[model samples]
Target: MQNRRLFLGSVAATAAVAGLSACTSMGGFSLTEAVRRLLQLSANRAFDRLLQPEGFWDDQVTRLALPDMVGNGRGDVLARILTGPMFKDRLAHAFNRTAARAARNAAPAVAEAVRGIGIRNALALLHGRPDEATTYLRGEMAGRLIDVMLPEFGDALHTASDPLIGEVMAALTGVNTAALANDLAVKADDAIWRAIGQEEAAIRADPRSTNDPVLIGALSVR
Candidate 1:
């Protein structure tokens, strides 16, 4: 079942690029191609900017720590013992490093979704408010990304050198491997969304960006 899902995810990604090829072959800037380019651009930009150890960790907004168990009995006690931000910072760094590594695998899934945009949808998006693309992407891609991220998160967690963090959490909060895996996957997804949103904002701000083929095609849709 897992293998099937992963296979399907890869297929979706391939399909996205296929859509791009098909549109490009049509020879003129069409709305579909525009949307494809925008989505592809956004995804590539996000990965490049946010899916690196330095990139992911440097962005204070996306760098996340383990959940604070401030009032949860033994969990709280352990949290206190963990104390200083350095340990948490190290843990966050490791978590982000894992996410960065796994993000490379998400390209296919992202591309597949870009292909899913319809002409009508593209027109709407072209005319919509500034952040519409980002919002649409979040809606369309989050669940798929979660499915894609889980296995990577699990593998990273297993290989990550954080025995003390894991030991404390397991001893105090009874967080087994599966729970940790899910948490990490969710965090990675959130980070991706944030990165995409940031890129979208940049796209909106650049007036010179109007010359981009995707933007040109999108605007011509009407």
Candidate 2:
């Protein structure tokens, strides 16, 4: 219990420091630059939290379902087989769990998106509305997500199979892999952005959230 408390306390301390750091301009800090760093921090933190097993399972907004096929014949048949209401609930749950398992492996992709942020773009995002940064990140990271997360998702999917899922995929062929990968990437990215936006809102609303004098000083100037 004491160890758990210490861990929580350390996490809180880190968040406070990050919040303060986001606001400050000392050591050649530009507000725009600080905001970019903050966005990256927020995005990474979001993925860290939301990619956990519970994060994907418990969050309604991010819950996964079997892909919906509009018209492709084989795909449609496959989708129906996988998504029949009775079968779908279990499959969806398993699908989300697979995504959760693959979450840790996605850090590099997230980091790359952060690194791609330019100074001009940072300035624009810093001054934009609450969800703008997240939107920008979604666009920037969307394509890369499939590349980064596909292998991890595939690995997780191998472990997540049930008898029904296994039988269907074997008979139908596992073309759903591409669809699942794309869906997981999109949903996971959205969940990450939501987490970042929430953190950003909290920090913007509260001045005493962190103790970093440098960050606080920088925030005061802007």
Candidate 3:
């Protein structure tokens, strides 16, 4: 009776070990899947925000107010004449309103790209430095968006019945579109850096995980 009981106990222990191994393997797979989903979701969210009006305006961090190209103060004067004493305020508000509407209009294309790109590359980006992911996604999508938005924006600007608004856009026309776009791009980049700094600080303050080794290594190299 004793020997028989021993054999049964051994058998039970072996079965338990096998079950544990399977569970561990499954857990690892789940973690990988979760990481992938997070990346896709985060990337999509960032891109969608970029094309949104709030993304362009409400966030003073990413607002697209261009400097007066006509001259310092002169641009302000021009804005006033065209838009009235409230010209600067109105122009800024209109730019934000229009950009937000336009972003909503461009959302479909952003969605399509998220679905089409496999999750691996984007996941790697999320694990990377702060703006790395944004830069990659922007590079992938911006050209296509520009192709669509430029003509639409131009048409909208042209049809703007407000003479003051028309004059401001006309002044902008004399400047190179590429230069203006670059200025906007720089501001966006600055915003990303600010975000990254905030995120890094939050991570460091927590008593939980250590700083990301990968990010640490990259910073050392830099």
User: Which candidate number would show the highest lDDT if scored against the true structure?
Assistant: 1
Candidate 1: where are CA atoms >4 Å away?
Answer: 1-27, 68-81, 163-173, 216-222
lDDT of 3 by residue, 136-201 (tens): 555666555554344444454667655655676566545654444344434444443333334344
lDDT string, candidate 1, 185-216, tens digits: 78777888777767666665662474685564
Across residues 123-199, which tens digit of lDDT does each residue of candidate 2 receive?
Answer: 45554665566677767665665566667666654553556556445545545666756766666655555677776
Model 3, clash count? 1
Off by over 4 Å in 3: 1-36, 43-55, 67-86, 118-123, 161-163, 167-222
Q: What TM-score would you give candidate 1 relative to the actual structure?
A: 0.72
**Candidate 3 residue pairs that clash:** 53-100
A best-first ranking of the candidates according to their TM-score comes to 1, 2, 3
Q: In model 2, what is the error at residue 28, expressed in angstroms?
A: 2.8
Error of model 1, residue 80, in angstroms: 6.3
lDDT of 2 at 182: 70
Each prediction's whole-model lDDT (CA): 0.66, 0.60, 0.48
Off by over 4 Å in 2: 1-27, 69-86, 156-164, 171-176, 210-222
The local distance difference test score of model 3 is 0.48
Reference-based TM-score of each model = 0.72, 0.66, 0.52
